[model samples]
Target: MDCLFCKIAEKEIPSDLIHEDEFVVAFKDINPQAPVHFLIVPKIHIKSLDQISKEDNALISHIFNLIPKLANELGIENGYRVVNNCGPDGGQTVDHIHFHVLGKREMLWPPG
Candidate 1:
C-alpha cells in the first residue's frame, strides 16, 4: 500500500513516534497547527470515517480510550481537540483513516 500512515505504522517511514500498540500508533505531525500537534491512526487501513464498519467498533473504541492518556502524557491534559476529516469536502488530505490530536493552544470555534 502507498498509504503514508501505513508506512509510518509499519516502520517503513520515519516518524517521531509518541505511542504504539498492536492496534494503533501515535506520532508528531510534521506541519503542526498548534504547539502540540500529533496524529493517531489505526494500524489497519480503514479509509475514512464514512468507511468504518461494525467490525471496526473495537478498534475505534480502543483509539478513543487511548486519547486521554496520550493527551496527559503529552502535557495537554487541560484541553485538546480531536479531529477526523472524512473526505475532500471535510478537509481530509490522506486516504487512510486518522485523527488529528491538537493542543497547547486555544482552539477557536467555527473551525475550518
Candidate 2:
C-alpha cells in the first residue's frame, strides 16, 4: 500500500502527468532516457508484468491502445519503442508494472 506509483495514481504525489483515466495514468519520466520518454502505469498495482491476471486483460489492452494515441499527440511520427521490464534482471527498477514510451529518436537494437 506504500507504492510510489500508487501515490502518483492517487495524486498524493505530484508528477508531470500527461494522461489519466479510470484505469491508468501516464506521466513523463523523471529520468528520461530519450527525447520523449514517459511512463504509463495502471492504477491498480500488479507488481510487474508477471503478476498480471486474467482479470486485468481489459486494463492491459486499454493501456496498449492509449500508447500510440499519446505518441501521435506528441508528434513522434518517426518511430517509437514501448519497453516493459518485467523483473529485476530485465531492468525493472520499480516493483509496480509500467510501460516506458521512448521516442523522438531512433531506438537501436538489443536495447540493454
Candidate 3:
C-alpha cells in the first residue's frame, strides 16, 4: 500500500524509532506537538479505528499493552495523552491507524 506509516513499519522509510516488536512500532513524530511526542502504529496495515474488526482485537490489545511501557521508558509516565484521530473531520491526516503518545506538558481540554 502507499500508506506512510506502513512504509515506516516496513523500514522502507527512515524514522527516529523508539520501540519495535512483532506487533507494533513506536517512533518519534517528525512534527511533535508536545515536548514528548511519538507514534505507536501496528505493523499490520489498518486504515483507521473505525475499520478495526474482531480479528484485530488481539493487535489492539497488544498496542494498548505496549503504550504504558513505552510511556514509562520515555519518561512521560507522570502524564500523557493517547490520541487516535479517526476520519478527516476528526483530524486524521494519515489513513493508517496510529496512536499519538503526547506528554511532558499539560494537554488542554477540547483538543483541536
Candidate 4:
C-alpha cells in the first residue's frame, strides 16, 4: 500500500485534512489550483472511478453526499467545481479516484 492518498487517509502521512469519516476523507491539495482547492478520496483503495464496482455503490453515494458540505466548509458555497478525471486520456495523474474541489475564483469555461 504505497498509495499517497491511502497513507494520508490512514494518518501515516500529514495532510491538511478538513473532514473524514469511516468511508472517505477530504483534504487540501498539495498543489492547489485556486485560493481553495481540496480533494475528497475514499479510504478504501478503489483505484479510479472507472474501476468502481457495483459493490462500491454505498460508499460512493456517501462520498458524493459529503461533497457539497466539504465545499461549503471550505467557503466555496457561492459556487465551485468538482472534477473527477477517470483515466489517462481524462488527465488523471494519480491511480486513485478523487474528486477535486476548486473554487475561490470565477472558473473559466472549457478549461484551457
**Model 2 regions more than 4 Å off:** none
Local accuracy by lDDT, each model:
0.94, 0.95, 0.94, 0.89
Q: How does model 3 fare in lDDT?
A: 0.94
| Prediction 4 TM-score vs. true | 0.93
lDDT string, candidate 2, 1-112, tens digits: 8899999999999999999999999999999989999999999988999999999999999999999999999888998999999898999888999999999998888885
> What is the per-residue lDDT of model 1 for residues 27-77, given as tens digits with 9 covering 90 to 100?
999999999999999999989999999999999999999998899998996
**Model 3 lDDT tens row, 33-95:** 999999999999899999999999999999899888989998985789999999999899999
Q: In candidate 3, which residue ranges exceed 4 Å CA deviation?
A: none
| Clashing residue pairs found in predicted model 1 | none
Better of 1 and 4 by lDDT: 1
Q: Give the clashing residue pairs of candidate 4, or none.
A: none
**lDDT digits (tens) for residues 1-112 of candidate 4:** 8998899999999999999888888999999988999999999998898899999999888887898887777778678888999999999988889999899899999975
Q: Is candidate 3 or candidate 4 better by lDDT?
A: 3
Error of 3 at 34 (Å): 0.8
Ranking by lDDT: 2, 1, 3, 4
Error of 4 at 27 (Å): 0.3
Each candidate structure's count of clashing pairs: 0, 0, 0, 0
